[model samples]
Target: MASPVLLCVGLSHREVPIAVREQVAVSADDLPEKLRRLKAIPGVREAFLVSTCNRLEIFSVADSRTVADDLLREVGPAGAPHAVVRSDDDALTHLFRVAASLDSMVVGEAQILGQIKDAHETAKLHGAAGAYFARLMAKAQSAAKRVRTETQIARGAVSVASVAVQLARKVLGNLAGRTVLLVGAGEMAQLAARELHQSSASELLVANRSSARAEEIAREVAGVAVNLAELPALLERADVVLCSTGAREPVVTHEMMVRALKARRYRPAFLIDLALPRNVEPSVNELENVYVYDMDDLERVAAGNRELREQEVARAEEIVREELAALRKADRERSAVPVLARLREHAHGVAKSEVERTLAQLAALDEKQKKAVQAMASAIVNKLLHGPTSRLREEQGGPLAEAAAELFGLAEGPGADPVANPVANPPEGEAADVLPISGRK
Candidate 1:
């Protein structure tokens, strides 16, 4: 009966440098291994990790603060300054905010929702998700959808691709004559290619596993289609490579790119990898005269969307606050369940013992009379406990109820049960910063 407590530790693009985030980036392929390592820690009943270019986060359910600390230590930098540690309500609220894009660099971009869903599924596939985390993620998803539907938060032209193109223009002086090599041909890649094309990139080349699909996208975008085999050669020719393939393995490995670099004789190339599994290898980032960026690096470009999304900030905040209050109320109501259950158990124990003692003392009575006496005792017990039971159910989180619980030994003391009455009497020391969950019930 260990109380379930959630822990969230994360580093985002806003907080850390791209180099740091990339170093700590848990690729989708490595998630299961990371989760296994996390669950092996002391008191960690369950664990999950969600890592994208914009954010890298670990969510876990544990019985002790030490477990959460271990999770942070494992996921965070040895001396990282930017990582945020959240527990309890704060963890829940942060997750909902992230899912809703309120915590994203681009406030209402739809990409984070898909990323969150993918992460959640990854956790489930690895057996890291249990009842508590599953319930929480479901609520977070629903809350995000509600926020999008009920508010104007998602309205307008906002996306990571547009932002990236805008940022590229800022860096490259002009995008008009740039040669853009489009890799992967996925939704994000298509979007980036479209944005670059619209921005007047002089030449566009689409290279993907499926030549036909690449051709289709290229034809539609008025670009040239090249076979995936030509990627290395194409790498030498393009000024910018926008890669967003679905391959779990890196399509552009460091060795492959090293040859391409040698072939091109060290020309500067901007490589943008937008795949979740990461189409480009991490080591390719080390290539001199090459600028490598992933989804996490896009945060710089996406940051501008924050200003546009600010127009709907008030409405979104109101929705979040209102939902948070309702969730808190429900959580408060649930806290009463344990107390009432304890009271019932105490009353039943007292009645059973007293009845047994009375029956022993009334040995001279006939069997029929004993049965009648037993019924009478049961009735008296029920009548005596009815008022207290009703009062206990109605007096949730009140001083009277807490006092009653203390006297009855219903509470296991501070930090022993996180889900008990956490918001009421938060634990001292390490558990003090735990926040309330602000998700929909």
Candidate 2:
């Protein structure tokens, strides 16, 4: 038997550029298949994967460092500088941090927490999550809720949509009484609409391929709705345009912008492209007075907000540390379970073996008397093992457990039967940087 080891490996916005992040991100539709494949890998006991615009992370339990290496190879390009690995305690801590949104590009964004939940649930649905991940994910979710409840980590505009609105304000000044255009009516577009509305964007205009969806969002914001075919015209009238559509190709091409810019006499328009495949053509960014910003640009804005939330971030970190310690303590207690179970089995086996031997000599006794003798033998074994069992549970990672194993002749050495010494040894050569699970019993 091999002791389970937790491992994580992948890249995030913290280390990789958006282009690279985009290249490796697995779509939500593709996640279940990826998770099943991960569980199929040799040495992996369980697996869960989180893939978002800002990060791509794989969380798993396996038998050795090879599992981490294997997972990295599965998800990341060879020698990818953006990808990194952590194991055991460090991996556990990382999971908590990610769940709590402390490791997010926006530090305290609420979306990452939901994204983590989605990933965990997907893994569970596919039968990839096991006992280890069940507890870990529960704790991570609890930690995230606690951070939001106890601190201001999630306060203010902590989303990409809000950040984009803030950037628009930075370029075009207060959105008060300004005309704002929303291009998709999707979640991000809706969020941007609300943010701009709160900023007193005087007029809201919605344009989408589906006139009904566009009208729905436009009505909600008390704005005018139009067909996406009218975007070239709307672009001329609006001051800021936020786009998040499902189009496979650019919705706003360079020629379209050139025409829109010429129509507005190049009156300086701010454009935000939130779609993954990008709603606006990249080349449109080169047009004069046609400012185009995408997910990466909003990240820069979020970074500034992160600086203001440094105190909240610090407070959040303290909470994670406290929770992590409690988690590890419980983990340490669990490590003793197998050791205690084996000890109990070995003791009972001896008692049974001896009881049978004594029964042959007790043929002179009545059946009732022989039953009493057998009960007494079992009781004595229980009493004899009770003290050691308590110590084994109480003093995990201490010498007493190993000492008791030796005393009972259960410890494995040269010529010892592997079947008899079923307790697994701690993994070796686990890099200090990788961080092994501590306090193995």
Candidate 3:
């Protein structure tokens, strides 16, 4: 029997705060690099990385827990003690819940599902994802679409982006004549740009290391594009700065921002640093007339969204529970394959031994008579074993499967004889070997 191809070991908003998640969230552009590092681990076979402001997770299929450990190690300080792990059916349930935004700070937020899709695609392009992961993600995505369409989950309260925009409206009263400067061309920045544009902001500037990408996003939003070299100058002129670049280090350091603040004569600047590892420096918050809001600060805004959608959240949770139960049931069924194989081998071996014994006892009989006796014994053996065989087959995929397999000596070997084929039987009473993420058994 093959090992389960479902495993998830990583942290998120619930387990760790934004401070830790920011360090680990693989940026969209460099996600392939992170995926490569994860796959290079010994046990990992197929892998996908889903990274968002709310969570950073690695979904994979592996032979042992070591693969998950290796991923955490490779992610360095970013994945440390904060990263949580799950395996088999639990991992599948986690992915489904994540896609449905049931695992989000604000439940039913739709942005995460799209981020997961993008992450899966990025992994696919790099050969990090295989057939199993692709199928799993497809199923999860399908489930998310179903929940969104079938229920009120996505009707009244839609997305984190929209919620952020709503908060901005409440804060500044009006966006007219305000200048919004987007620090990166990433998805979060783009979403913010869309919101700002829709609110009829007077001007927009997109600054990025890749001027072409900046220009690309800028054109879409009817904004101007600037190089990273020009951000210092642009920062002084903008009223709102949404920073979400891919730099490992802080792109908007406190000192540099202080200089920009001085240039603007300490005027109030609404800064939303939406990057993980945070694009803006934490110290920048101390500056007067500079209101800096990162993901952590957004929790207050998320809480507001949560309170608004309290009634709808119950429905989403119910849907997630139903889906998770079905997935767990399916997993238990797959886990029973080894026991069924073992039972079949044991029955065949006993029948063979009985035939040999009866043949020796009937040596004095004629050849025809001996053959008749052997055939009769064979039929009787088969009939006697029929009930157990049927039961094993029928119970292969239910809740009782694992306990039942352990109770029978049926889970003993790879072949008919346990002594002769010890390797086939998993270490006495141990579970069968599962396939690792490395694609080897």
**Best-fitting candidate, scored by lDDT:** 2
Candidates, ranked, lDDT: 2, 1, 3
TM-score for each model: 0.74, 0.83, 0.77
TM-score of model 3 relative to the true fold? 0.77
Worst 10 residues of 3 by lDDT: 416-425
Q: How many backbone clashes does candidate 2 have?
A: 0
lDDT of 1 by residue, 1-441 (tens): 555666787777666665566567776667888888887888887777888766888888788655656776776563145677787767777788898889876678788889988887877877877766776677778778888998787875567777667656655658888899998866777887888988889999988788899889998878999888988889888878898876657888898888888888886778888775577888888889777777776775566666666758667777776776666566556666666777667777787788789889888999899888778877887888788778866765455556667888877643236543333333345444642222101
Candidate 1 collision pairs:
53-296, 89-435, 89-436, 89-437, 90-435
Q: Count the backbone clashes (under 3 Å) in each candidate.
A: 5, 0, 10
Return the lDDT, model 1, position 262: 87
Evaluated at residue 364, the lDDT of candidate 1 is 92
Candidate 1 lDDT for residue 240: 83
Best by TM-score: 2
lDDT of 2 by residue, 1-441 (tens): 554577788777777776677677787777888998999999887889998777888998886667776787767572255577877666777889999999887778888888888898899999998666777888888888899899997889788877888778878897787888999855676788778877888988889888998888888877789888878888888888988886667888899889888998988889988766578888888998878988787788788888999999999999998888676556545545655777788888888889889998778888898889889988998999899888787776335655666777665433232221111232344423452222111
Model 2 steric clash pairs? none
Ranking by TM-score: 2, 3, 1
RMSD of 1: 6.5
